[model samples]
Target: MPSSASAPSRARSARPGYRAVLRAPHAGRTFGAALLGRLSYGVVPLALLLAVRDATGSYSAAGAAMALFGLASVLLSPVRAALVDRHGPRRALPPMAVLYSALLLAVAAATARPGTAPAALAALVVAAGACTPPLGPVMRTLWRRLLPDPDLLRRAYSLDGVAEELLFVSGPLLVGLLLPLVGPAGAVVAGAALLLTGALLLVASPLAAPHPRGGDREERQAGADGAAGGGRGRRAGRLGGGRALRSAVLAAAVTGLALGALDLMVVAFAEQQGRPEAVGWVLAALSVGSAVGGLGLGALDRPLPNAVRLPLFTAGLGVALAAAGLAPNLLLLGAAVALAGLFVSPALTTSYLVADEAVAPDARTRAGAWVNTAVNAGSATGGATVGLLVGHLPLPLCFALAAAPALAAVPALRTRDFGGARSRRKSDPAPDPAP
Candidate 1:
């Protein structure tokens, strides 16, 4: 064994801190591919909404389609994630990508047809959404596999949050650039192409490929089946995370509901003013704020404990949204939305981190899927809500719908149930004064 003199140095190096985490194996390659695939997430909803609006001439119809899309996506995410965890990305991602792209093209074809019924369009959107590649959860889950160290994992999540913010901004900007030239249907086609390409790259990355299957495959698959098995499941094995997982999922659901409304209102704000193309720029402003927040959080040596911060960020989101409701011009609206968005990615990152902490390693993907599920479910609520409220009421008041749920999320975070984390960080007790 090394002498005590060298012990400190060995311990420090063994930390495998944030930089080392990035350099770990296939981390960068896998993440970059997933980032490209995720850009389509920003494009598809808006593209579909615009396409439906162009075809059906009804914002209500467009909203219904979006709600259906989120609903389908939310329902299917967990199942898809479980498949990834058990079988790995190579087997899972490619088939989902293919089916998802096909369905998107089907939706585009229907949009091209002049007289497709509104209900039919909505069904098509749902079908397309159901096929969305489970790449997001798969990628997020990769962090846990790649970095077992707590601090490094936290930093990776923060960086992932920043990347997601960038994806949102760039994805929409891309759509805006193409809108004038290609029209809405063409935008959908473009988004599908990116998603397909990204999915392929993501699977090809060695990081996402299945590890050597010893006996772990059966164990992970078993976890998938028992995750929701109630009280008895909790006692069984690592399969069930019990109350903490539920609480985290609950928080994610509430957060997602609030965001979904904000998305709808932002879109409506531009469309109502006869400058629909400006939606991308306004959203980009919001995402810029989010990126800044995420990066700042990530760069900190010892970031604020996510448990304490998650609720605060979510509440801040409510405040920003409330301010946004009063914005009278595009500039003011962009600023207001950006302010709220500052809290968005941070909250999401915290949720992902919390999910990882709350669940067993085998179920990390499914846990991530639960977070995605909440977001999509909330998106459905917000989209459908704003869709109905768009013409029937003053647009500003509709923002309250988004704010109320967010403020409500504040209470959900009060649960002191998440296990395996200390409520307070250990004090350094006066960092041994330098001699």
Candidate 2:
């Protein structure tokens, strides 16, 4: 912890950068450990897909297993986050990590030999998915505990978002490296090991210690209510009490949907140009643009309030997506996609900020998880929607259609309920003494 004398000087610094975010006591260790664990999320999907396919010898079976795994993980995210919120990370995370790791090892074992039953793989994958630790949400909550200044928190979240994006990108590469040595089954084992180590390190961080103001107070209150006649009112009020949370979730969902559609749209565009292999390069541009945009957001000392910024960023992404459809060539499409990417990270970072601030401390993890759920669910829906429409509709029209949800979300986000000044007043507590 900083000396009392140093706190004032720290506060007076104009704009906290990513460097400052890292410099927070225990911040770097805590965040790095979280990232290490999150890398498993990046690695496991492709690794599992390949492992299953190799074992089952059927693309359809592999697809089904992957779908089951993803669906279970995405759908249960909020439940896992709620566990962390109610029980605290130290109590909640380890058991989840252990269970998930064990399941992954089971998967690896099953895939070690050929002709593993598709039914067995699907069941194992679903169980593993359901047990997947909510490390991302928990880490974001830790950031809140570590950095109370909204500016520093903004920087922290932006950094987190960008790092996560890179992790997902690099995860596949790591599997590629491991493939010759370990094969896909071995890659699955590596993911499990990474997850277990990261989760253990993360929980051990001093920064991840249970907040005095978080779960305990809520649990006590709930017990008191149970003792009296007021039953489950707190549960009812859990994630639905505020307009800011709702808008943040809605915007995140739409933005995710648009981006998901863009992925397929880009492929379609590349194929139409008779250069299918160019898809990776175009997507790389998108990732780079998002990284730059996220860093730019973190650099801002003073920025528009989340209420205004969320809608603005979302709309910018929508407009860019719509414009991308008009590009007749791959170069132009890539450029447009990059432009759209500029809004992606900023929008997501702001949505997380909104979600964090909109809820009570104990509820923050679940709030953030809701945003995560929205994004994943939206992305899935968008990809499926575009898949159905791609051959049936003109490519340009499909692009415009992909952009529509984000455009429509803008006005809903701008309502008085998400009023910038009012929401900030409600959400921004005085900087909690740096833990």
Q: Choose the strongest candidate by TM-score.
A: 2
lDDT of 1 at 109: 88
Could you tell me which residue pairs clash in candidate 1? none
Each candidate's number of clashing pairs is: 0, 0
Reference-based lDDT, each prediction: 0.76, 0.87
Tens digits of lDDT, candidate 1, 176-262: 999999888999998898889999998898776565664346445444444433224432134355555665676677667777777
How well is each residue in 109-128 modelled by candidate 2, as lDDT tens digits? 99999988999999999999
The 10-residue segment with the lowest total lDDT in model 1: 422-431
TM-score each candidate.
0.77, 0.91
Backbone clashes, candidate 1: 0
**Model 2 whole-model lDDT (C-alpha atoms):** 0.87
lDDT assessment of candidate 1:
0.76
